[model samples]
Structure formats: C-alpha cells, structure tokens
Target: MTGTMQLAAEGASDHRGLIIGLFGAFVVATLAITVWAGRQNKDADDYYAGGRSFTGFQNGLAISGDYMSAASFLGIAGAIALYGYDGFLYSIGFLVAWLVALLLVAEPLRNSGRFTMADVLAYRMRQRPVRTAAGTSTIVVSIFYLLAQMVGAGTLVALLLGIDGEAGRRWVVVGVGIVMVLYVTVGGMKGTTWVQMIKAVLLIAGTLLITVLVLNKFGWNISALLGAAAESSGKGTAYLEPGLKYGISDLSKLDFISLAVALVLGTAGLPHILVRFYTVPTAKAARKSVNWAIGIIGAFYLMTIALGFGAAALVGPDRIIASNAAGNTAAPLLAEAVGGGPGSTGGAILLAVISAVAFATILAVVAGLTLASSASFAHDLWANVIRKGKASEKEEVLTAKIAAIAIGAVSIVLGIFADKLNTAALVALAFAVAASANLPTILYSLFWKRFTTSGALWSIYGGLASSVLLVVFSPVLSGSETALFPDSDFAFFPLSNPGLVSIPLGFLLGWLGTVVSKEKADPAKFAEMEVRSLTGAGAH
Candidate 1:
C-alpha cells in the first residue's frame, strides 16, 4: 500500500514536470514575439488596432482566442466531469450569446466606434461623462476578468509544476503580464491578432483530438458513453434528461444557473471582444468576423460535451476528487488515463501539449483585456478628455503602456486576495457587471433616439451600483466566514447570480432616464447617430 501510494505521487509529479516544461516553452515564444512587435509600435493607432489592417478571417480567429479564457478551457471541462449534463448548459449559453452579438450588436458598434466602446457612446453625447463612465466600466470589468485569469494561471502552474502556491502564481502572473504588455505595446493589434489565431487553432485542434480519442475508447457510442457517465455521476436520469432536474436546491443546480447567465450575456459585453471589432477594416468585415467566430465557438463547445463525459466515466470521481480537490483537473487526468500512465510517451506528450495550450490561451486573453482597459484609460479618458485631445501619439502610447502595467499589478494583488474563489464564478461576476453597466448604454445610445445623456449617465451608475452590490452579497462572496461580511455568511438572495435580475434593470433604468429627460435631448444629433450607426454613412 505504501509503495502504491508512493508510485501514484511520483507519477503525478512527473506529469507535472512534463506539463510545466511545455508551458514554459510557449511562454518564452510568446514573450519574444511580443517584444519584437513592441519595437514596431510607432503610433496610437498601431498600438490599438494593428493599424486596422486585419481581414475578417484573421479577426475572427483572434475573437475566438479572446473568447476562450480559463473558464472555457478549465472550468467547463471540470464542471462536466463533476455534474454530467448540467455542464452542457454553459456551452449552450455561450453559443447563444454570439447570436445576440452577430444579429444585433456587431456591425453597428463597428460602424459607430473607433477605438473604444466609449467612443461610440460619446460620438453624440457629452464626451466627458460618457468617456469617464465607459472608462470606469472597462477598468472594473477588465480587472475582474484579469483577477480570475491570474488566479487560474497561478493554480494551474502550481498544479502542473509542483511548485509552492505563491511562487507558482506570481511567476505565472508576471510572465503573462510581460507577454501581454509586449504584445500590445510593440506588435499592437497585428501581433495580438496573430497570437490569438495561432492559440485558437491549437485549442480547437487539441480539444478535437481528445474528443475523438475519448469517443473511440467508448466504442464510438455516444448514448452508451452518456449512460455510463449518468450512472457513475449519481445524478440518475436527470443527468441525461434536460430540465428534468428543475427546481432542485442542490449545489449542482445553483452552480448551473450561475454559469449559464454569466457565459451567455458576458460574451456579448466584454471590453476585449468589443475592441476586436475595431481591428476589422469595415463594418461588413466586422459582421463577417462575428459569423466566423460563432461557427468556431459552436464547434468548440460541442467538443466540450465529449471531453467532460469522458473525464467523468474513465477517470472516476474518487480519483478525481482525491487528485484535483476541486475536480477541475479531471480532464488532464483523464487524458493520461486514456493515453496510458503519465510516464508513457503518449500520455506525457498530450499532457504537455494541453498545458502549453492552456498557458497560451490565458496569455492571449489577458493581453487583449489589458490593452482594452489601458486604451480606455489612456486614450479615451486621459488623452481625449483630460488632455483635451492635445497629447502627441507618443505620449498617448506611453500612457497606455503605463496604465497596462498598473492594471496588471492591481490584478496580481486581487488574484492573491481571491485565491480560494472559483475562476468560473469570478469571471461570471465580471460578465454580469459588463452586461449590466456597459451593454445597456451602448445599445440604447446607438438605437434609441429618446436616449438622453442623463439617461445614459443614470443607466451606467444604476447598473454599475446594482451589479456590484449583488456580487458583494452573492453566495460565493458572502459564503466565506473571512470575507467582507464575516458576521453574515449567507447571501440575502439564495441565487449567487445577478444577471437574471440586474441586466433587465439596466435597460429599464436607461429607458426611464431617457423618457424623463426627453425635453433636454438633442433631436438632430440623435438622427445623425442613427445614420452613422445604421447606414455605414461615416465609416472609413
């Protein structure tokens, strides 16, 4: 028994080394590219959008890279491994959100805006308040997203390298931060775009390979594989049957709804995703990019179903619980089991590749988020609003770089503080805030003539306030005894998710504010906004 336990520990350690080495190699390569690109960043436009030269296909690939974060890679697979069919709800919500982007939000946003979403809203409204609010929202959402990514990176590195906790996480954060600063400051959009495209391809290819292998191991039988997973999961027929487990008050049900709301609405409103649209040369290209993104994202989500079930059945829950503690490590462990033991050549190679891909995914996404947040602060608010649009291109780019570093540091601090929280849940909170605070103002500004500046202001403030308060009182936040409300661990609301409640309130507040301020609203300015956003009249 002692020898067997020792062998298991040794096997896990060897697997960790293999994965860490592969991940390290990818980080070095990304850093080199970022540095090379940074040397060529000549102006603000270059730093912001790679001089707006990307084609639809390239931009589409980059979008996929940005969209697939730690949540898509680690969280989804882990959830599926533990919870069975409930995990697929995340895939469905994510895929559906792209439709909202494609059919409603994509082209108009591209046609109306230049660098930031604030630019779109401020095109007609008072630029000061609009830029300030937008910048604040961008920073808030990006920081939230960044913290989640940093925490995941740290946890993953520690798990993969067998390093001590803080050491592993700090190294991962610093490595990722430097690579991102290099990508945005030097290569600008061009470098970021290429990196994203490469990462997306790697992620998709790796997932497909794993899915195919898993299915083959199950005798190419989907139903039988699911049946086995359902039985093993202890969730009974509810595991296979959709909505049959409705109204259960278990942790599984709570987690399922929270995940669904965050994945769906969050994708549509993310600052990094909105910024990607600016890289495309035309509004039509922006539309095309979104369509391609939908198809790619859809395929990836479909593959996740197989990967999750494969982990649940073949790896077994007991081993997963003992090894991962959080159950998120099930996918990689399952990969090793499928290929053979960790010391086997095939198992080691696949494990190495998956870890490398995960590392690259986090790096690409954090870079994009940092760039967007930096641009919002330096370009939209500081350069344009505070400097009265007087700063030189060099000064503006310098400011953005400085902002990126500062934001990166802040994210590291937050990541350390929130280490115990789940990455998926934190990311969902960020999405809820984005959907609540930013999306409503953006949609109304472009489409509603009655949208007064006062309405926009109130909407931004109201949404931001409500979402933050809800998150603060959420089960995830308040459930901990050491958290902000140590005396009261139970949330005021049973549900941790706020999107189901706060998103609608944002829209309603915007409309009400607009209606109340109708007399003060500019009619001619509203018409011009409609033309610019809807007809491609001013697009360059």
Candidate 2:
C-alpha cells in the first residue's frame, strides 16, 4: 500500500508538469490570435462589432464558444455526476432557451441594434435615461457571468496544481482576471471573436475525444455505461432517477423550478450573447447564425451527458467530491481515468489536453463578457449620455479599454468571494438577474407600441434591483453550508434563485408604469422601429 501511494504521488507530479506546459502553449496560441486580429481594427465598428465581418458559421461557432461556458462544461458535469437525471436537465433548459433567441430575438435585434442592446432600447425612448438603464443592467449581468468563468478558472488551476484552500484559488482568479482584461483591451471585438471561434472548435474537439473514449470503454453500450455510473454513484437506481438532487422537498422542487425558468429565459437577455448578433452583416446572417449556434451548442450539450456520467462511473462520486467539493474537476479526472488512470503516460497526456481546453474556454468567455460590458459603458453611457453623442471613435474605444480594466478588477474581487459556489449555479443566478432585468424591457420595446420611456426605466431598474436584492438575502448568499457566507445566517428568501418572482414582476412593472404615465411614446418612431425590426428596412 505504501509503494502504491508513492507511485500515485509520483504520477500526479508528472501530470502537473505536462498540464502546466499544455496550458502555457494554449494561452500563447490564443494571444497570438488576439494580436493578429487586433492589428486590423481601424474604428469603433471594428473594435465593437468586429466590423460586421463574420460569416454565419463563424459567428455561430463563436456564439457556441461563448455559451458553452465553464458552467456548461465543469459545472454541468459536476452536477450530473452528483445528481444524475436532475443535473442533465440543465442542458435541456439551455438548449431550449436558444430557440427563444432564434425565434424572437435574433433577426429583430440584429436589424435594430448597433454595438450594444441599448441601441435598440433607446431607439424611441428618452436616450439618456434608457441608455443609462441599459448600460447599468448590461454591466451588472456581464459581471455576474464573469464571476462564473473566474471561479471556474480558480477551481481548474487549483485542482491541476493540487493547491488547497482559498489562497491558491484567489491568486488563480486574479491571474485569470488580468489575462482577460488583456484579451479585451488588446484584441477588441474582432480579436475576441476570432479567439472564441478557435476556442469553440477546441472545446468541441476535446469533449468529443473524451466522450468517444468513455463510450469505447463501455463497449459502445450506453446501458453498460448507465449501469456502471449508477453503481459507482453509490445510490443504485436512485442515481439514474430525478429525486437525487432536486425533487426531495417542496423547497428543493421550487428551487428547481426557478432554476429552470432562469436557464430557459435567460439566454435571450445575456449581454455577451446578445452582442454577438450585431457582429454579423445582415439580419439573414443573424438568423442563420442562430441556426448554426443551435446545432453546434445542442451537440455539445449532448456530449456533456457522456462526460457527466463517465466521471461518475470512472472517477467515483466520493473521489470527485474530494477533488474540489464542487465537481469542477470531474471532466478532467474522467479524462485521466479513461486514458489509463493516474500513473500512466496516457492519463497525463489526456489530463493535460483536457485541462488546457478548459483554460482556453474560460479565457475566451471572460473576454466576451468584458467586451460586452465595456462596450455598453463606452458606447451607451460614456459616448451617448456623458458626451451627448459627441465623443470621437478614438475616445470611445479608449474609454472601453479603461472600462475593461475596471470591470476585470471588480470581477477578480467577487470571484475570490464566490469561489466556493458551483460554477453552473453561479451562472444560474446571473441568468435569473438577466431574465428579470433585461428580457421584459427588450420584449416590450420590440412588441408593445405603448411602451413609454418611463416603462422601460421602471422595468429595467425595478427588475435589476429586485433580483440582486433577493440574491443577497437568499440562501445563495448565506445560511447554508454551501452558501457564499457559510458562517452567517442572514438568508430570508426561501428560493435559491429569484427568477420565478422577479421575471414576472419585471413585466408587471413595465405594464403598470406605462399605464400610469401621462407621457406618450412617439407613434412615428414606433412605426419606424417596427418596420425596421420586422422587415430589415433601415438596418445598419
């Protein structure tokens, strides 16, 4: 037993060297891509919307890269390994949400907007107030999304280096934040989009490699895989069923419902995701991109089922839990196991390759989130509100770069504080906030002729305020062992997610604010917006 333990330690040391080397290589390659793309930017369009140059397939792939975040990879895999069927449901919600983006938001938003979502929201409303609200909500939602990627980075680096406790994770998070700010400030949108397209391809290829290995190990028999996973999960048949994670009690069930709502409705409102639509040249390209994104993203999520169960079957649930306590390392551990376990060269190579892909994914995502938020601040708030549309393109781009630095610093701080939470759950809270604050205002602005400037302001501010406030008092923040503040008990809200209540309230506030206000929206402007949205008559 002593000899075997010594051998395992030696193997882990070997794997660590290989993993770090691969990580460095991937980062260098992506930075090269960023620098190469950055040299082409000549104006605000190039920096903010990739100069509307990407094809449907390219933009589609980038969207897939941005959407298949660390939450989709690390968080979802960990959830499934621990909770079985319930965990896989997160994939279903995410995939369904894309349809909402495709059918309702894609063409219209592309036709109506420019660099950011505010361009559309402010089309007919009071520009300064609506832009302020949209800018604020965009930054807030992007920050929430940024936290997930940063936390995932910390967890990934910690697991590979065998670093324990908060200090290791904190340093990793800060490093990730710095790297992301560099990606945004140097590359801008064109550079970032190219990196995302490359990252998406790498992620899908890595996932396919692991999925195939897992299937082959099970003799290509899914039933065999399921049986082994169920047995190894230490829950027998319950591991393959629904109640293991979420359906146990009324509160858990309600939490599940809220989670589903957020995941399903949140994609359309995501600032980074929404901004991707503006990167294409035509509304047709936007629609085509959504189709491509759906196909690519759908296939990736299906592969995650294999990843999640493979981890359970090969790595064992207790070992996965022991690794990070959040299951963020399950996919990487499973890669090691499938390639012949810890002591072998095959295991080291696979682990290094998989982990490298994960690092690249996190980097690319953080770049996208930062770019979106900074664009909102510079284009919507700084240029339009602060400078009253008089800021030069050079000045606007400079402000965006500075905003990226500030946002990166803020995300690094929050990432340290929220490092204990699961990446997928952290993203779910972000989704809830986006759904509550951004979606109702977007939908109303596009569809309702009576939507006044006050209605938009009320909806955006009210929804944003309510969801964020609920999260602070909810179990996600305190009162439970898994909460961010585990030592305290200030949780007053019962549900872990606030989507179920906050989303409806957002829509309600928009309606009520419209009805009570005496100010009339510009009918001529609404007619023009409708024509432009539906028929692409005057799209930029």
Candidate 3:
C-alpha cells in the first residue's frame, strides 16, 4: 500500500508538469499573436474591429471560440455528466440561440454598428442617453460573463495542478485576469480574434479527439456507450431521462423554462459575440460568419454529449462528484481514464492537453468580454458621452486599454469572491441579463418603428435592474446547500433564473414607455436606419 501510494503521487507530479508545460506553450503562442497584432493595429478601427480584415470563415471560428467559453465546454459537459439527459437540454437551447443571432441580428447589426453595440443602438436615438444605456447593459452583461470565466479559470487551474485551498485559487484567478487584460490591451480586437481562432481549432480538435477515443473504447457503438453511462450513473436507466437536474416541482419547471428562455435569446445580445459581427468587412460577410459559426458551434455542442456521457460511463459519477460536486473535472478525468488511466504517460499527456485547451477557452472568452466592455467604455462613454464625440481615434484606443485593465481588476476581485459558485449558474445569470436587458432594447431599436429613446432606456434599465434584483433574491444565491450563499436562505424569489419574468417585462416596458412618452417618433432617422440596415446603403 505504501509503494502504491508513492507511485500515485509520482504520477500526479508528472501530470502537473505536463499540464503546466502545455499551458505555457499556449500562452507563448497567444502572446506572440498579440504582439503581432499590436504592431499591425494602426488606429481605432484596427483596435476595435481588426480593421475589418477577417474573412467570414475566420470570423466564424473566432465567434465560435468567443461563444464556446469554459462554461459551454466544461460546465455543460460536466452538467450532462452529473445530471444525465437534463443537462443536454442546455446544449439544445444554446445551439438554437444562434438561429436568433443568424436570422434576426447578424446582417442588420453588421450593417449599422461600427465599434460597439451601442453604435447601432444609438444611431437613431438620443446619442448620449442611448449610448449610456447600451454601455451600461454591455458592461453589466460582460462583467457577469467575465466573472464566470475567471472563476472557471481558477477552478480549472486548481483541478489541473492539483492545488488546494482558496489561496491557490485566488492566485490563479488573478493570473488569468492579468493575462486577459494583456490580451485586450496589447492585441485589441485584431490580436484577440486571432487568439480565439487558434483556440477554437484547438478546442474542437481536443473534443473530437476525446470523443473518438471514447467511442473506440465502446467499439464505436453510441448505444452501448449510453447504456453503460446510464448503468454507471447510479440512477440506472433513469439517468437517460430528463428531470434529474430540473423539473422536480412547479418552481423547478419554471426555473428550467427560464433557463431555456435566457439561452435562446441571450446569445443574440451578448456584447462579446455581437462584436464579432463588426470584425468582418460587410453585412454579407457577417451573415456568412454567423452561418459558419452555427455549423461549428452546433457540431461542438453535439460532441459535448458524447464527452459528457463518456465521462459518466468510464469515469463514473462517484469519481466525478468526489473531484468537484459540480462535475467541472469530468472532461479531464474522462481524458485521463480513456487515455490509459492517470498512471500512464498517454493519460497524463491527454489530460494536460485538454486542460490547456480549457484554459485557452477561458482566456479567449475573457479577452473578448474585456474587449467588448472596454469598447463600450471608450466608444460610447468616453468618446461620445464625456467628450461629446470629439475624442481622437488614438485617445479612444488608449482609453479602451485603460478600461480593459480596470475591468480586469474588478473581474479578478469578483472571480475570487465567486469561485465557489457553480459555473453554469453564473453563466446562466449573465445570459438572463443579456436576454432581458440587451435583447429587448436591440430588437425594438432594429425592428420596431415606434421604438423611442425613452423606450430603449426603459427596456435597458428595467431589464437590467430586474435581472440583478431577482438573481440576488433567487434560490441560486441562497435557500439551498448548493447556493452561493448557502449559510442563509434569503431567497424571496423562488426561481433560479429570472428570464421568464424579466424578458417579458423588458419588452413590455419598451412598448409601454414608447406609447406613453410625449416624445414624438423620429420618422426620418428610422427610415434612414432601416434603409442602411436592409440594403447596407451608406453603411461604414
């Protein structure tokens, strides 16, 4: 027994070295890209939109990388591994959300927007107030999303390096924060896009590799794999059905629906994802990017089911739950198990590579979020709001870099504080806010002729405030052992997610404010925006 324990310890040390080495390689590669991007970035256009240089295929891959954050790759797979079929519903909702982006948002937004989402939103409205509202929503959504990625980063590092305690996790979070800030500050959008594109390819390749290996283990029979997963989940065949993670009660059902609503609408409104549209040259390119993104993202999510089930079948729920109750380590453990166990060189290498990929996913996502938030700050607030649109392109880009640092600092603090929270829940709240706040205002502005500045402000504020307040009082924050605040139950709101209530309230507020306001409709501005959005006439 003593000899066996010594050998296990040695194996763990070997794995750590491999994981750190791979992570270093990824960092060096991405930083090189950032350096090159910095040299090429000549103006605000390059800093914000990569000079609109990326092709549809390139932008599409970058978009997929931005959208497929650690939450989507690790959290979703972990959820499916832990809860079985119920977790797969999230994959469906996320994939379906791209349809919302492709059909309703991509072309019009690319045609109308320049740097930030506020550009498109403020075009036909009161510039200062509209931009301010959009900026606020962008910051809120991005920060929330950033927090999740950062926390996931910390947890991921701790898992990969076999670190213990809050101190190690905090350091990991800070390191991730600094790296993300550097990526945004140095590379801006151009550098960040290339980093994401690279990470996307690596992420897809890693997922595909593990999936194929898992299938090979089961003789390439998916049915056999599912059967084994169900058997090993301890719940037997019941694991193959829904309602394990949700649908236990009326409120649970409502929470599930709310989660679905958020995932379906939120992807269209996420600032980081929407900004990808502006990275391409034209509306046609933007539309093509969305189509390509749909294919890539859809295929990735489908593969996640196999990864998740393979983890369940091979690694078992007992091991996964022991490692992390949230199952965040399922994929890594699955890699270890499928590659010949943690004792072997193959297992150590595969786990390390996947770990590196997960870290890259977090880094790319956080960089995009930071860029989106900083762009909103520099473009909408600093340039237009504070300077009255007189700020030079150089000053705007500089302000963006500063804003990235500030946002990264705030995210570090928030990430450390929220490290124990579930990654999927944190991401869901971000989506709820995006769906409820950003989407309503954007849809009204783009499609509704009667949408007023008053309506836009109302929608943004109403939805933002509601989502925040509800989440604060929701069960996810308290009321249960898994809650972020598990010691006390201050959950006045029964639902875990607020999208069901807040989303409708957002749209309602938009229409009601427009109808009730004494402000007259600006028909000429609307007509101009409509023509520009539809035909790309006079669009920059």
Candidate 4:
C-alpha cells in the first residue's frame, strides 16, 4: 500500500480501538452496578429515593456530580478559552444558584415531597391539574436537557473515534440511553447515587491534576499565566473583563443580566436537582448537603478558570479550532497536547481517562434526568391521575421503569435532530425554562398561603409557553438571522435568554389567578401545606 493509505489505515485502527475500549468498559461497569442495585430494590421508594438512606456527605457529592455535567466540563473550559473572564461569569452564576437552593428551596422541598417536585406543589392544590402541569414541565425540561447532553456525547465520541458523525452520534445516544435505563430500572436510586458519587470524584481529580500540572509548568504564577493568556488571545484584556467587546449594539448589559438570572434561579428549579433533596434522610440533611455541594462546586469552577486560560495560552486558538467552529474542543485538545501528543504515552493515557470520565459524566447525568422525568410521569401523572390516589409500591416502580425507557427513546430522537446545536446552549435553555415555569410556582406554593390550583396551572402554562416561544425566537434559534418575526428587521428580544422575562410572568400569573380564585381555595389546606413544607409533617 502507498504511504498515504497506510497512514489512514493506522489512524482509523487507533480511533476504532479507543472508542470500542472506552465504550465497552463504561457499559460493563454501569450494568454491573445496575444489576446489583436492582436485586436490592424491593419497592417504589427504593427505586425513587434509594430508601432515603444516604448520608449528608454522600448525597452532597452526588448532587455536585449531577450538577456538574458535560456542559460544565466541556462548555466552561471552552468559554474561558474563547471569552476569558466572560467564561468565569458562568461559574459565578452557577455557584450563586446554590445559594438560592440552600437558603430558599432545599429544606422546604425535602420536607414536602417523596418523589417528584409536583408532589410538593400538589399537596394543597387540586391534585390533577397541579400534578399534570408540573409533570409536563418536568418532562419538557428534562428532555431538552437530555437532548443537549446526548448531542455533546455524540460529537465528542465522533471526534475521538474518527467515525462518521451520524454513526458516532447514534452510538452516544444509544450507549447513554441503555446505561441510564439500567441504572434506574435495576439499581434504582442506590445505584444512581453511587455512580454519581464515584464519577464526581474522578471528574474533579482529573481536572485538578491538569490544573496543577498546568500551573506547575507556569511556575505557579497565576498572574504570569493570565498575562500569557491575555497576550495570546485575540480579544486581549477585554476578554478579562465583561462587555468590553462583542456587544450587539448596547444590549450587552441586558444579555449579562439575562444569563445571570437563568443560571442563578435555574438550579433550584431543575427537576433532577430538586429530586436530590429527597435522597437525604431528613430536611436538615438536605440543607447540609446543599452547603457541601456549593463548596465543592465553587472549587471546581475556580479550577476551570485556570484550565481554560491554560488551554488558551498553551494550545492556542488556531490549532484547537475545528471545522465546526466551536470552542468546546479546546479542553480535550489541550489535555491531549499537554498530557503528551495524541499518541504519546502520557497524552494518550490522560486523554483516554478524560474521555472515559466525559462519557461517564453523560451517562450519570442522563440517568438522573431520565429517572426524574420517569418519576414525574409515572407517580405524578399516572398514579395521581389514572389511579386517582396513591399507587402501590409495585405499581409505581413498574410504571417508573417503563417511563424511563420511553423517555430515553425520545432523548435519542431529539439528539439526532439537534446535532448542529451546542450542548451548553441547549442546557442553558433548559435552565431558563425551569427557572421560568417551575421555580416561581414552587416558591409560592411553599411560602404563600394564597396560592391555589388555578394559580399554579396558569403560572406553569404561561411560564412554559412564554419561555419556549422566546427561546425559539432568540438569536440562538434563528441561525444566521434574527428570530422575532423571521422577516422583520427588529428582533423581539435583545438577549437570547428568556428567564428575565418569563420568570416574572410566572409569578404574576400565579398571583393574579390566586386572587381571582380566592373563594374556591380551602383555607384549612394552608396550615397543612405549611407544616409539610417546613417540617416534614405528614410526609411518608
């Protein structure tokens, strides 16, 4: 064979071996854990909340694991590489969201519900409409989030394996779908918890190792590193500050606020994050877990600043930029270059481990999201609506497993269609929707006695509709042009984020609906709702 053909064959062989090995190891490990956990799962509670047996520390780690997804791993690093200090904005926004969760949402949510966030909302309201609305929101948000993650996984796998994009994407979606199904179906909460905990530690350690080495190479001087990054970056010191450049008109201020709002409130409203509160043994444990999660997450974000700048200075933008024209590849490329050349011993090993961890991150997060969506559909919608009362343990668990498979299938389909979008952007949309549709209703339901079922339904529908519509019309959705009227010269919204608009709408709609339906609400239910939300009275 000619030299060119021989080189191509060797490259293809290496790519194929890497993909198969990493993917195979992930599947085997996930399945083993699932089967072991499945044997221990005897009831719905075990399937849903791991029998609420987790200690504060374990649950905290799992929370951090779930929260720090592929978006955090790849997206933040890429953002820093491209945008400098603008990227750290995401870290700050994400970390601040934990404060909202800890001070406002955590303990009350744990005290109120058993499985889904809807359970808490429906406690004092009419069960059918409340459960229906909350379940719809949960499914919508979770699927959107899952689609983003699956897309990221597919793209990463394709890049690493040197395979056709479509085939690689399908493999990622299928791999994650099957693993998540097994995780929720067999191991239930127990298996999911351990998986997330282990993955979190590995992810942190892996990133930290890279950060340490990168710093060591720079002689432990942060200022020197930043100066190098600033000099090398095309944007200069402006990248170190927010809004010095890249402003579309004077709207940079609005865009900054919009992004901040989405990240801050979004975490508290996320179905997967809220459901974690149920995993802790008590309300107090849930609160403590939030505190621990915040600290861990904070440290991780801080490391990303170093890693992103390191990649910016060390790898340089031109070499890492792909034909696709996104910054997400910077982290992986940097790891390969710094650890060693792609085929070098150090580089190859580090890249393999990072790839494995990235794959694991996708699996664990999708599993949690799928589980949350399943529980919301099965328990909140099916059991509450179809059965008209509490479901037997067997029935609830069975329905949940079935729901898991169904949702996973939907995610795969969406991932296939969303190949062109950035996973981080899609995840941000999920956060915006969650913040808009679910957060306000939850907060009011727990703290405001005036809240009624009518109010919740209206708020949920309004927020969901407005947020989705705004996103579809935002610049991110338009692609090459603005969205508002498609043909119109003016874009409807200045910022791509909709949380700033939709979140307030949710609260206003809820308040207005409550006032109009005042006479229909039962005042007696107020006392009960307060007790359940604050002290776990009647939770079982």
Q: What lDDT is reached at residue 423 by model 3?
A: 79
lDDT of 3 by residue, 47-138 (tens): 99999999999999999999999888888888899889998888899899999999999999998888888998888899999999999899
Per residue, candidate 4 scores C-alpha lDDT tens digits across 216-284 of: 878999998898888778777786777643353567667767778898999999999999999888888
lDDT of the structure predicted as candidate 2: 0.91
Better of 1 and 4 by TM-score: 4
* C-alpha lDDT score of every prediction, in listed order: 0.77, 0.91, 0.89, 0.79
> In candidate 4, what residue range of length 10 has the lowest lDDT sum?
1-10
User: What is the TM-score of candidate 3?
Assistant: 0.97
In order of appearance, the predictions have TM-scores of 0.92, 0.98, 0.97, 0.93
True-structure lDDT of candidate 1: 0.77
Error of 3 at 194 (Å): 0.2
Ranking the candidates on lDDT from highest down gives 2, 3, 4, 1
Could you give candidate 1's per-residue lDDT for residues 140-198 as a string of tens digits? 99998997788667766555555554665577667666666767666666677778888
Q: List the residue pairs that clash in candidate 2.
A: none
What's the CA RMSD for each of the models? 3.0, 2.0, 2.1, 3.4
